[model samples]
Target: MKRVFWRAGLALVIALAFSSIIYGTSTLKNMQEQKKAIQQQIKKEYEELKAKKDEISLVYQEILKYDQQYFEVQQVLDVLETRLTEKKTEIETTQAQLVTAKEKEDVYYKNTKERIKVMYEYGNTEYIAVLLESSNAMDFYNRLEYLNKVVEYDKTMLRRLEDIREEIEETEGRLIIEKAEMEHTQAEALIRKNDIENIRVLKSQQIAAANKKKEFIESEIKERQREEALLDKKIEEHIAAIERERQKQNNNALKFKEGFLKWPLPGHYRITSPFEKREDPFTHKIAMHNGTDIGAPNGTPIYAAADGEVIYAAWMNGYGNTIMIDHGKNSSGQHVITLYAHCSSLVATKGAQVVGGQTVVAKVGSTGRSTGNHLHFGLKIGGAWVDPMKNTKK
Candidate 1:
């Protein structure tokens, strides 16, 4: 009876244990499903957010394009204005010359007319009397020669004055035509400026709309900051690795002339951001900008800052498409490196040699953590990041 009672109790315990195991398994499965659903929802929200940000990004690109165009047009307008000033001066000078020529012609004409009038008043009798009063054949011959010389001189003077007037008139005509052409060109440039202004106004409206969603943009900027941090680490590691290789190779020979670095993006010298500590664009916190941000149109060619070997040309986390060149060493025996980031596309491949101010290393872009199209240029020396503008000055 005791053995049977013990077996019954053992069976009851087994049943309870089995029931608990099944319930635990079921609960675990349900929890996993819930977690997966949450993950899916989060992913979906992220995608939606990305889509909205991309739409705004496109608008920003358009604004950038128009801004670039406006700059170019303004440059053209400046040149035209300068040329017009010069043209006006030239026209004034030509007019002065014309007036002088006219004055000379009028003086000669008045003198000749006075001479003719005096001779007419006196009549042919005077000439007849002088010739008749000659003493001999030699005297008459001398008198005739003198008369012929006087007539020739008068004719020559009149003809020369006519030629002078004609030449001056031709010059005036040519200048007038050139001035008109310049005016026409100036008008066209002004028209272009007006058009650009109108477009700018439209862009301003778009920007205002974008401002309405500032919260979203601020969030995106935070995301970019995180990515930028990661990219900064990657860049430092890359530079270190390249430097190590260079040191091992003992390739410390200077590869370029000692001077200020070439401005990487030609015709785009406007520094959108500097390499100094400033309040972060969106975060409102003090942050150090590691590089100089040069505003440029998308796809603008980015040249190598100095003669160097392309040690790295690949996609980085937040820098997007990047190109790094190792410029051997500076006069101080410090290894110099230049980095160009946020490229639309890279032209120079890894390990390729490049010439400063000549090689098209990459194209400008708004890739990675960028808010607009620009060239983010960084300078590294002796394994430390320094202000590029300061280094260039050195």
Candidate 2:
């Protein structure tokens, strides 16, 4: 009996240990699955954020295209309006001339009618009587000559009347054609006006929709800040290395033109945001803006700040399409570098030489963390980022 009880207890212990081991294995498997799911969720969120950014960029680009089209239409409308005004003036002048012509025609017609009536009343009897009463052959011949002159004058009056009638008909035909052309021009102008209005409405609607998605942008603020800092550090390191190498090579320093750096954007002087500490657009936190933001229409040409070699021309972490030009050392021996960011397209390639105020380096755009179309320009001198406005000239 004792042996039987001991065996039963051992069997119970074995069964309990097996159950515990199975439970532990199941819990471990569940934990691993949960971690994998969390990673996937994070990845999915990041992808969604990228997609939203791309969508905003495309929207801005579309709006820019519409803006250009609107400008072109406005020009056409102005020309049409001018033509219409000129045409109205021409028509008015023609109408006055027609009135004058008709008056002259009426007067001549009345005079010719009177002459015909008198001639008809006298008929050939007066002419024959005058010829018979002539004192000699010379006088009779003179009376016959006078009769012929009178008949010729009557024929001239008839011909003049026919010419006036033809003039009236021609004037009337020209008036009709002018009126038709004016109407056609009016129709064309109306179509252009309508097109401009439609584009304006679409652009306004798109802007409104974009504004409503501010929350989405706000979510990316923190991540973008971190990425920007990292990118800046990377740039600083690279520039420093370049300067060191340049210094090592005697007379190898890059050359730049004299005077202040050329303004990157022409016809775009409005500063959307200055290089000062201000509330961040995305985070609403006080942050230092390392660069100046110049508001401009998208696709506006961006020129090089100074003559320099293109060092970096590619997409950056938060700056989107970016360009960096090394303008060598200044008169003070401080290494000068210029940065242009958030470009829609890049014109200068890396390692290419560019001229200040002459080379078109890129096109203005709303890329990366931008809220609208503009340029974020940065100037680094002696390893420190400074306000670009201080060294730029329009």
Candidate 3:
């Protein structure tokens, strides 16, 4: 009876142990599922944030185009302003000429009236009288010439004064028309300048709004990251266990063989900024630059740095549209990692295998902490930031 009781007790304990084990497993699975759901939510939110950023970039590009047009309009306005000044001076000169001609016309008419009265009083037959007094043919010819000269002189003076008056009137009329045209041009230029100024103000407001939106989105992203970090730690721990078991079975460590890799970018690639101490664009403080900034036009293709596994491919804080590759081991037995940042779009997925100088991983962009379109390439030795130029070829 005693032996049978002891065996029954042992069986009960075993049953409880098995049930406890099953319960623990079920609880852990539920926890992992909850974490996974949160992670998925983070991913959804990140996507929305990036979409807003892209919109902002497009808005900035539009502003740039408008600025170019504004500059051209301003140049035309300058010319119009100058021409208007010239027209004003011309009008002044024309008015002065008109006044002088009017004065001369008055004098000419008054003098002519008096001279005509005198000629009438002195008898208008002077030419006939002089011809009748000639003694011979030669004398008659000389007296006739003198009379013709006096008559022609009076007629020529009147004709010259009349011509001068008509010319001044025509010049004044032309000047008035030109002045009106210049005033119209000046008005049009002012209108256009005002329009451009209004556009600039509007664009400035939009740009500020965009920056605010970015800041808000970035804050939210950071909060989400903080929450996700806890989950990530647990997930990494689980993955590390699996990796350790696999490495034990192989009797070897996970390592990559190192070699001189091909240059990731193609076709006359230039480093806009080098990996050195420089002033931070945002803070204006001196800081160390960890990577070389390769300048490129927006949408320029980006290739993988070497043959490696894509360890991370996503948008990260301060490193937008980032890709991180694990390229085996270096001479110091440290894991060689290369990072690419500020891409417009990504083609490679996480955990994807890629070949050096071949895979088109992303396109260059001005995504995060950047002033223009470019790629930020980084190197990490033993998980610490290192200069990529040491390993770069030309």
Candidate 1 clashing pairs? none
Across 261-325, the per-residue lDDT of candidate 1 in tens digits comes to: 88888787899999888776656778677789999999999999887777778776667888888
- Model 1: residues >4 Å from true position, as ranges? 1-38, 129-135, 204-214, 217-394
User: Could you tally the backbone clashes for each prediction?
Assistant: 0, 0, 2
What is the overall TM-score of model 2 with all chains considered together? 0.42
The candidate that achieves the highest lDDT relative to the unseen native structure: 1
Tens-digit lDDT track for model 3 on 189-288?
7787788778878877887887888788778778777877876786677566555534432331133333455566787478888888888787787777
lDDT of each: 0.75, 0.73, 0.73
Highest TM-score model number? 3
Estimate TM-scores for all models.
0.44, 0.42, 0.52
Output the worst ten-in-a-row residue range by lDDT, candidate 1: 1-10
Clashing pairs in 2: none
